[model samples]
Target: MLVELLLAAIVLVLLALVLWLLTTTRRELGELRQATAPADAVTELLRRQIEAVRAEGRDGQEAVRREVSDLALRMRGDIGGLQQSVASELKGVSTEVTHQLHEGMKLIQNAQTTMGDRLDRAAQVVAEVQGSLGKLGEATLRVVEVGKDIQGLEQILKSPKVRGGLGETLLAELLSQMLPQEHYTLQHPFKSGERVDAALRIGDRLVAVDAKFPLENFRRMLDEGEEDKRRPVRRQFVRDVRTRIDEIAKKYILPDEGTFDFALMYVPAENVYYEIIIKDETDLADDPIATYALSKRVVPVSPNSFYAYLQVIILGLRGLKIEANAQNILNDLARLAGDLDKVREPLRTLGRHIGNAQSQFTEAERALDRFGAKLETIERKGGAQAELPEVGS
Candidate 1:
């Protein structure tokens, strides 16, 4: 891989000189510094040259490490996972390089001990060492330049100039649209004593969500100032993040001032969260540092988390819809029950009248049967009187 990278550098420097600033600088510095300085001993100069190249190589490696780590924080899905894997592999490479550097240090000490009496030869050796250092310096510069190419793309994606970020804005939009307009509300200023990212409501319950992140620090650490300067800024960046958490809690988490329940300290950048808590020395237990501080329960959502929460909220909304429909159905059933009661009273009165008419018809038929029996008895008595008179004669 190093051999291929070296060959690529040669083509880029010779044919396409636009991206080969290091090669050009090396050539110019050589031409300018060309002189026969007989006063300076070559061996010591060579040793100094070697040290300088090694220092530059170390710088280049550190820069590359920071660039890759920052990239891991910005990307999502498989790209993010790949970035993480590459960062770990780079760290492994650094450990191996450190071992090699120690070996080189031992070799330098041996050379210095053996060549104590050879000043003229040492001066020539120094010249040769200077030549090697120059090449190594060129190599270091090439590595840094390639790191720059990749880091530039990372910077563009993480920048918050476009009404915050794609991830944050998308999260805010979804929360705003999910809840009913009357039930839940959304606000955006983003937790710097300025904007609240999003707000949600259900019944009398209210919550504020703020997406606060400092993405520029890692890039600045990659590209800017000395270590003494850089370390302090990085520390302050983490401290400022705590201050922002405090600000978000104080400004947005008022139970009586409209936000009920508790507020959400949304970290739209999940990678940033991992960098701070998992990679850095900070812990969740000590994150807030105050009783009223934004709780660790403050939502840490990735793009996936937001979508998942949305799915749950939709289920709740569907439940509410079902409840409303059931209430309407119950009201209709009550109205039908009242109408049925009125019809039932009229049917009962009609049944009573039918019973009275049937009883009167039965009494009239009994009276007619009694009159027929009386007539039949009278005919039988007349026939018996006629038979008795005939026997006496």
Candidate 2:
């Protein structure tokens, strides 16, 4: 646009210069005619100069036109190349954007797959936890039921008869576990018309056990708070235990019925056993319950101590049986030794008779061989072969 405007201004300036030159030449021609000397030559020279200026202006206008056209063509080519380069760059940018979008989609899909697997595993873990919680709930219910049963048993144990029964049951259970059936008897009756709780048979001897425990006063003594009150209850408790021991001694220790000189008094409750033993240890020897019981041949035993005693008795019985078997074995061996001595001479005589019979048989065989050789020689001399003595003869 600027080049076109510049060419138009140059053409306008050239036209204005030609018009000014024509005006100046016409005035000079008029002046020369007025003067009338060389007016025609000057006018001809002015005409030639005006024609040269017009041609030069024409050439300049053509050159300016050519320059304007070339500039327009170059600007168009530059604008086209710039448009193509921009289009190619835009295409590359679009391809890269498409590739990036595809990669982003793939990443999102992979993330979704990983999240799904993790959620499935978490659900499995939750199910397992729920199952374990169910099992734990059942175990808690069982524990509550067991607690109720224990409370009920405790209430039952407070009765005197129930306590006595429990003691006897415990004693019986210990006997069953520690002794063979033949070695023990339950509720064994003595000649004194008293039925003992249990008895152990050691060889031909019997050892009675009494399971009845006098626990009423002992319980009262334990429950009382005042020292003065507890002292009387304790003394009464000790007296009751002493009386029970005397009764057991009088009834169960029957030497005439094959019982041992002493009897056993089993106290099933460990606390009661310890109380009596502790009293005996701390009290005066003359008034000691243990000493008094021992004097009457009534021995006090706790569950653990009685078990130990039973083990010793079982061992003693096994030793006695082993001793008897060993004695019988020795007797049998002695009898076998005597019988072998009696048969020794007969075996020697039988061996000598067999040796003599073998020697006689050997001599008869040698005689038979010589007779055979003599018969063959006679047959060769042409003589009638004499009848050889029969081998049997």
Candidate 3:
């Protein structure tokens, strides 16, 4: 726009100059014609100079117009190029912005997927914890019930008959849990008409277990406060344990009835068993209850000791079964090895027969090759008779 305005101003200035020159020329011609003759040399020379001035003025105006037109063309071309550059820059920026937006959307989608998976796993963990808590609550109730039952058992132990019955029941329960029915019996009768609490059959030997416990004197000894009274009760307790051991030995350890030389006196109570084994801890002489019982072939056992004995016996039985199975397997393997050795002889003979057959086949092939050569020789000689080998050779 500025270039066009400048061009218009230049054209106006050229037109104004031409109009001024024309006006001056007209006035000068009027003055020259009026003051001098028409053939005057001064008047003609002035008129020619005016005509040259007019022609130069017209040429200058034409050159100025041409320059303005060329400058306008150049400006228009620059403006068009500038517009194209700006449009291309704007398009590149739009494409970049679109690409960034797409990438951001993908990242957001991935984050959502990962978050959903974590939420599902967290919900599953919460559900599993709730189930475990329910099981734990049930287990807590069972423990409470077991505690009550233990308290009732303590009360039952106060009665002598109940205590003996409890021991028998415990003995029965252990036998049932640890041993097969065929290996043990409850209140087994003998030829002497004597009944024992329980008997374990180990091979041909019977191990009698007597569950009678003398607890009154032992409890009195433990309860007595006076040393004088306590000492007497302690002595009585030791005497009672010895008496029970003697009774068990006399009744249960029967060689003629296929029982062991020694019998087990199952005390069921650990405290009583401990008292029988421990030496005197007072001014009194050492208690010889354990020694005396051992001498009489009577072994006193507490619940823990009896359970250990049962475990040992069970392990021994399992060992015997495994040993027997191993022996049978070894015998079978020996027989199989002998049978394989017998089969080896026939296989060796068959191999020798195959080697002989292969040797005979090779010899036959060579003989056929020799016979073909002889026939070819006869053919070349036009069927002439040839000497043949003797049949014996």
Candidate 4:
């Protein structure tokens, strides 16, 4: 548009210049005609110059119009091609963007599905955890009840008399399970007018067992936390055990009273027994406490060890009973042999009588055969006599 406007301005300026030149030439021609005869030739020459200028101006105008038209056509053609190229590029971009959006939507849907599945699994896990927590609560309640029962038992065991009775009861139960009624005696009195916890009869002797043991110091030793605090309590516990052993040995182990040389000190609790019988590395031969008890002729026994002792005693009793019966069985067999000797002569006499009877019977059979032969001879003679009579007739 600027180029067209400039061209139009140039054409207008050329036309104005040409009109001014023509106006100047006509004034000169009029002036020349009044001044001289050569004015006609000058006017003719000025008119030809003016016509040539006009022709040249028209050709320039035509050339300018042709160039403007060519430029406008080229611009239109370039604009149309550019518009088509832009449209093609826009279509391709739109298709690519739509494909990308479709893929993005699919990815989002897959992600949502995966998230939903994960959420479901998480919910299930939460439910399982809740159930486990409920079970844990129930177990905790049960543990609390058990702990309370244990505390009550601890309180009951604090009394020395109750503890003594409990030990005796446990001892009696073990004796009853392992031995016959006649084999064991509970609270068997001694000649000193004192009674032992129990006595087991072995052959002609008795094994005295005492169940009353001191446990207070032992319990304290276990309950004390620091080693320094436990040291004195442990020493006291050992002394108490040794004292109990000495007392049992003095009271129960009486050889004159048919009691065994050694007596049993029954400990009802395995842990307490372990404490009494534990050995240090320096006491390699045996446990020091156990050795001390042995030296006093009192043997410490826990429930388990006492049970084993009873089993061995039962087997020994059975062997003794068998041994006693064996002698009686031999005596009875000897008497049976004498009785057999007494019957031997009678049986021999009966056999002689039977032999004599068989001989007589054989002789009687021979006599019967001789009688039958005589009868046959008589019959034959009778038949011959009958035949002679018939011939005479």
- For residues 1-393, could you state the per-residue lDDT of candidate 3 as single tens digits? 676787688778878988898898888888878998788588668868887987887787778778777877887888788878988988998899899999999999999998999999999989999988998998989988988998887677889898888889999998999999988989999887989999998866899999988888888898899988898888788778778888898889998889989999998878777777764443446447777788998887888999999998888778877988999999999999999999999999999999999999999999999999999987978744445555798
Candidate 2: worst-modelled 10 consecutive residues by lDDT: 278-287
lDDT of 1 by residue, 217-298 (tens): 6556555668766776666657766676666667776766556545655555666655554466433444433332336334
lDDT of candidate 1? 0.63
RMSD of each: 45.7, 11.6, 14.3, 15.9
Order the candidate numbers by TM-score, best to worst. 4, 2, 3, 1
Tens digits of per-residue lDDT, candidate 2, 1-393, equal: 654576578667866866786687678767766877666687688678768766776776677668766876786687678779999999999999999999999999999998988899999889999989999999999999999998898788889899899999999998888888999999998765789999899989999999998888888988999987887788888889889998998888899999999999999877888889755443333578887888998899998898889889989999989999999999999998998888877887877877777777777777777888887786776454444455777
Off by over 4 Å in 1: 1-168, 173-195, 218-234, 277-280, 283-297, 354-393
The pairs that clash in candidate 3 are none
Compare candidates 2 and 3 on lDDT and give the better one.
3
The residue-by-residue lDDT of candidate 4 on 229-271, one tens digit each, is: 8887877777777778888988999999999899999989988
Q: What C-alpha lDDT values do all the predictions have?
A: 0.63, 0.84, 0.85, 0.86
Span of 10 residues, lowest total lDDT, candidate 1: 288-297
Off by over 4 Å in 2: 1-151, 279-286, 354-393
